[model samples]
Target chain A: MAKKAFNPDIDAPEYKGKYSPYDIIKEGTIAVVVVALLTVVLAVLFSSPDEKAVTIKSWSNATPMDFAATAMTELDGSSGTATYGPPYNNAATGQQVGPLTLAKWMGINVNVNTANDFVVAPLSTLADQPALTSALTTFASASSSRRANWEANYSKGLSSGSFSNGVLQVAAANAGPLPEMLGALTAMARSGALDQALVTQKGFYTTDYTKPLLFMADGSFLANKAQVQHLSGDQWGMMNETGSYPGQAWLWLYTMWYQVPPFSTSWGANADALVWAFMMLLTLLLALTPWIPGLRSIPRKVKVYRLIWREHYKNM
Target chain B: MTTEIDRQWTTRLRKRVVETLPPDKLLPDTQPAYVASWIYVFGVTTLAALAIVILTGCVLAMKGPLWWHLSGTGHFVNSLHLWSVEIFFFAMVIHLWGKFFMAAWRGGRQLTWITGVVLFLTSVGAGFTGYVSQTNYDSQWISTQAKDGINATGGGAFFNVLNLGQMLMWHIVLLPLAAVALTAVHVIYVRIKGVVPPFEEGK
Candidate 1:
């Protein structure tokens, strides 16, 4: 019984011409051996990367000023993760792909209040500090606009601030209690208490580091490390791994869009949604190419299959 | 008991399965002579590498992140897993490229092509999750970076990349299951359809 062929214009007729000896089980066994040996050799030559996760303690201890500066941004609600709407909060309008704003439509699910999660709550965890406790209360008592003013004033003081013996020396005028509060918070970050305190999930399995990563991302410390490792988005980081280790090279086409015109320039803000949309469209086309007229004809027009079937054609 | 077995659903399913892919076609002593190219071997190569990936992954899973980071043998196993994944995708892509040129979708094999596409996409996803589940600096950077794209597409509501437990579970379990299932379906399609006939020139 012969089967009906697909579209006559493009699809080749069912092959009934020739047969030859082929031991599939033997072929498969050889392949397994060959591939196993290849991977083992590659692994031995170039092992994987495993740089340890950065803790808040390391960040503070190594660069106390960077931690303090980042803490100030978190307190003032001016950091990247603080304003990273949708999954985090409704800080800004979520991403839009032309008419569709999918991020906004889904709404906030992670519910990260950067000020409390990154700063105040960590300070609140300290065992017993009278001045820190009083500063928290004073800051909590102030109005939103007043707090903004105090934050601005402290930010001004940070420009000329100095630290020695784990104490920040920011000028304390209209800054209100921020000097006292940040002093305590910086000390907490250094003690590694801030890292644990930020893990506020009320569960025994508190392995999710969403809160801490968000806080870390808001600071330049992590980004600095990423730059050194050649993992920044603009550097085609999607296809990169730390050091010389091979990355997700399979993501080449997906990540290449970031380096091109609109993604690199005009549409930077909406590039994520658009690039995703574009890749999806391309994938759909690739999947449905058999049914597509011009695309299905490419194999015939290109004649690459001739090379693939050279021996058969040679006999013919 | 013989009569009961003859009337069983299991018997009917067995008949149907054998009918679809008989022993001869499933493990044939011969394929078409046109399947002589080196390009044809990558499909099996890919399958082999995928097996290595799973085996190494099982070893890594047994010990968990701490051991993989601190212990030397753990690092070697982790390396095997990573390199196997690299080879898996490498060979898979080559297979896809060869199939595309040969138009393996001809002769009612469109579903076969689609399955390969799905497998490729799923494998890429599995690779992505694996990167994010390392519980290392790579995980930290990749998760934070990938979250935006996921969030922008409104996928973050369910798939929170920042959550290590969630990402690790998906990496080790969910995505691998999907990829394996898709691979099974893809291979079954190949078996049922019989390896696609070579592109007949001047058809």
Candidate 2:
């Protein structure tokens, strides 16, 4: 028949005895003031936008040959994004990860043929030029190794090549139908018509990786001329530069992981897997901290929370 | 005699129960043993940063996507938004790590821990959406590239990166709402349960 007594320990000290509601309001007011001050300080100092003009028209005009070379290089699987697996393009079955079962479960979703999409498709629009058209058709039909050999030869030739009055001339041995095809592409680029070719796609127009990757990769050309004036991977952080503007510096943590040798030199897919694994480990550590022996002891070890409630503890 | 005995027994039982209660339990006298100093402000600092993000995000949404390119005021507002986001994630990461090391989720507060993890995931989603809505050439590229990953994983059917309209809607409305909702629930639970008393005190 006896009633249970309410335990006072269950009540917060701030709610007890002579403490007024104003005490809570006072703490809240201080917090608000601190936040407002910080926000204003950040807004004033870093307010300038990083906006710089970067359009396809401007870029193609500035570096026509470079653009053409890039387009051609992509056609030969030497472009940085050419063989980027999974998200950008589907890897060949042999190049795919995991056993047959897992690979099949995921499947090859983002199917892309860099040579076809980045080169042949665009050149198809320019098929009226019989000579250039024939070169593209021949290059497209050639074996991958033969194309690779040709590009390798051409790329090597460019190392010692010279330019005269906007004309790039390489050794006659390296000068083949590919160089002539590149000339037409360069002329098209200089006129700013290349943008149209780069973006124009067939089918439902669901996805266009060409423009974005091109926009990122072509700093030697026009679009990123102002923003990513520096073409090194370190300067642009392995992604597209957003005008002249600052970008996600927080990504430093992620990109820094790549700057090291093993990650930087590893195969593209393997590097991605490494980063993904690292993130997974971090997440798991965070989730399991409560049960982890050394981690669970940290609060008591640090005793920082005692300082957080010092005034209350002082009275006690 | 029976009525008197019953009444006496009830009175005795009540007194015994009162006496058995620990003195610290009877009075709110046991102080929190964790640090209660001004340096603990980082936790609240993070929450403040999230507040800035929400407020600036609201203003930007009211003006729409082209605002950053439309007027000087709009551009400044957009700058504020970008800075707020930078600060929010920065603070969130620090706060999350601090909590992790402090074992702040101990003593039957697993839900708080899980909710924090969910908030982190939601924030990343929000960040990705925000990046896409920038509408720059970079935004254009990131969206197209990110779609491949999303599509490959069968997430494209639900979350289409190329659909600017869909992305803008999620960035402004859906994802933010989910983030705020999750945060609110997390906060309420924390307040109700109160901070887990220092680990050693139980031992």
Candidate 3:
């Protein structure tokens, strides 16, 4: 195919107008220096938030019962990760946009088995202890009915506020080996080994934090901390900075969807999917504003350009 | 039909480069007096903020996230990186609005406009990745929160926000480099195009 001629008139419009000597280097240098000073002054006046990272160890230590109960939820396949279909598991239906099953189409790529990944596997390393080993054996070998009964009984005990001294003080009946498992898991978590255990991957480096993070999300501990910082979904959290600081204000358009209408109130509203789709559509709209009939006309309709280059348009 | 000289990649590229950005066009010491508008200053300010962000990011990269958490100087540098980014986005938005009203995309400078818009989009991704890489509670909350949206769009398979190493590399290496390169191209186009002839008297 032959290329079109590069017309100087169209490609590079000739400039025949007033000119001013502009020192690009000097202007750039001044801007940089001014910005650097501003950054330094802001940094000195208001230091960045250094809130320590939340670890499984801290979560388990501070609130063992929540950690233990959350573990039980993971084991029974009732936790967020357990039921979070697609890219993880299929316990629950994946998100959709109208008839389009967006998440299910992506499929389960991360492959998280909440029962094994979140609980059993992490506890397997501690099998040297007779109680834990026996508990694991009992839990693993038990029939589905028996395991379910045990979990139900333990969960009931938990609801009754039977926990005493980080040990769930459940009545012996129907509890089976659940107490042993929960006790051992709590101990492991408090000892800070749970953090290491959760991240223990196939390779020498254990950087992928999917397992640990999923486990955290299953519990209210992390969520509560976020709420304290005003970083919750309903709080326009995605754009908020920690504490009283202003967050990524540019995200308002994206986060605004979460605060209103069908997204906030609809039972089937996959907020994430809906928001992502909306933003993408909006971005494309903005990018094509020049081509879109009404949007393209907005610049001329507003006439703000006259104010911007008032000096140039003065003769009009 | 192609000669060896014409077929050479460097020769073709050089010719195009020089033709498009001749000496004066590439580095002009003078600009149209119509560029006097205060709105023009925001673009330069945005670039200035980006420079600070990159410099502070480099320092943070050298010492790692842990050092930034513990050392006072590291904290200050990290803060600088954060604030610079805040300013970068802030100024860029203003510049974007200003140019939009001016119909800066007029003439054959559509590529220039497109590049600037794309640069802003990439910077948003870069900023989000930076937040996720902070290794603080904020990062934890944000990444886990963000993963849902990304995954819903089928981006989780590759762009796993929970993966610290992945997000870190993107923040420090990939996104920044893409943004910087795009910014360079955008600025070159601006220079070559000679800052859209201010909307004339009648048309």
Candidate 4:
């Protein structure tokens, strides 16, 4: 084959000078050992965090009222997942980036009915509970307005309920079958059945935890735990670990934007879409830095490479 | 025989491969003197960390989640996996910074830089999924929080963060496959282009 012509603009500077002996295998071996040693040292110093997953049983046992109240919201179609639009349901308009409702366009692929999936369906599986069974049947047959009325007042009454002695006692009139339904659900949660129940509703493989996690998210259990660990969105939780161990430090640049004015304030529900879009745009800009005029010139203008190759420069 | 060689696709491929990278150039014994830099080591350091990460992850996967949570050896391997991943990202960031500051893309290596950036993005996905597949509170909380951001872009349509099976497959199989392949291409480009020379004085 003939030698190809080299264009100075895109070609590497043709090296006619003396080259230095370099053992790439030796260098690579040293790096592998050094990096592996560093990893072992870090791992020994700080073992990874494995905080016990918050099961529905644990949540219910700890804060029964929160469980009951959230269960009511799920029934009323007012919980976070209940109103979470697209991929879950159509209760609300999904997040939008300016004009593009990408989530809405994606549609309800998960098909979560918070009421059925979170509460009724799980409760329906419980055998030999006539009152609970009756509540499920009545709740199912009742008008949407009547069910909403029942769930609302029960939710309001849940504000003062005492969940002591493994019992939920609320004093809300017109509560109808809710006390029975929620009470049964709370017991189901406390027994650890709800966790399996929520997951089992999806499949036998038991892979997806979306139902249970969504239900738990509606309550304060998950967030409360997160708050103690400084793992909330406000705390740059995306870059956080459970304890003092290192986290996803690469995401700091990404999560930093949320703390500023736009994402934390006016953007509200659309904040996620906007932040995601902005990060993508920034990544594109970073990738294309070689083509961007001032960005590309920064390396030469700053002369950082001169310092990197100082030995060669000194010889020159 | 010479004419027959030209007609064979396999022979043509072999010729093309050798043409692009002859035996000596593919694994050179000498490099440009300007390649001497502490920063230049980071690329290999990142690669080393990734190897450890994969090794630890394979061990963890072999024993399953319950074993990792229960057995002391499993726990240590899990720690190794986590720390190795952290080191991988740490070294990757340093390498990226070093490459950027050195203008490594100068010698028609734009594809190298672009692949690296895409590799970084792929890595972020891999890391995010690893967190989501931990089967612990961190996974639970992260999935819930990340789902909103994910769904906002309809990423949840396919890559449901809450789906542990899906995330585990992606983390272990799909993303790693992509990352390793991209790393190969990136390194091949580096070898082909040679270490980029420093900018000409004052220009």
Please give each candidate's TM-score: 0.96, 0.69, 0.94, 0.96
**What's the candidate order when arranged by decreasing TM-score?**
4, 1, 3, 2
C-alpha DockQ of every model: 0.75, 0.15, 0.60, 0.73
Query: Given candidate 2, what's the lDDT at residue A109?
Result: 46
Cα RMSD of predicted structure 2: 9.7
Listed per model in order, the count of residue pairs whose N, CA or C atoms clash below 3 Å is: 0, 16, 0, 0
Checking candidate 3 for backbone clashes, the offending pairs are: none
Candidate 4 lDDT: 0.87
Local accuracy of candidate 3 as per-residue lDDT tens digits, B135-173? 999999999898888878877766788888889889999
For candidate 2 chain A, the 10 contiguous residues with the lowest summed lDDT are A8-17
Preferred candidate (TM-score higher): 2 or 4 = 4
Q: Write the per-residue lDDT of candidate 2 for residues B133-179, one digit (tens) a residue.
A: 77665565556445543543335445667566678889988998999
lDDT of 4 by residue, B1-203 (tens): 57976989998999899988887777999998888888988899998998898888889888876688888888899999999998899899999999988888887899999999999999999999999999999999999999988999988777788888888999999999999999999989888778888766543
Docking class for model 4 is: medium
Q: What pairs collide in candidate 1?
A: none
Query: In angstroms, how far off is A165's CA in candidate 4?
Result: 2.2
Could you give candidate 2's per-residue lDDT for residues A75-191 as a string of tens digits? 667665565443345543222223322223454444556667655666677757889877877876877777777777777775566555766676646445677666665566666
Alpha-carbon interface RMSD for all candidates, in angstroms: 1.3, 7.0, 2.8, 1.5
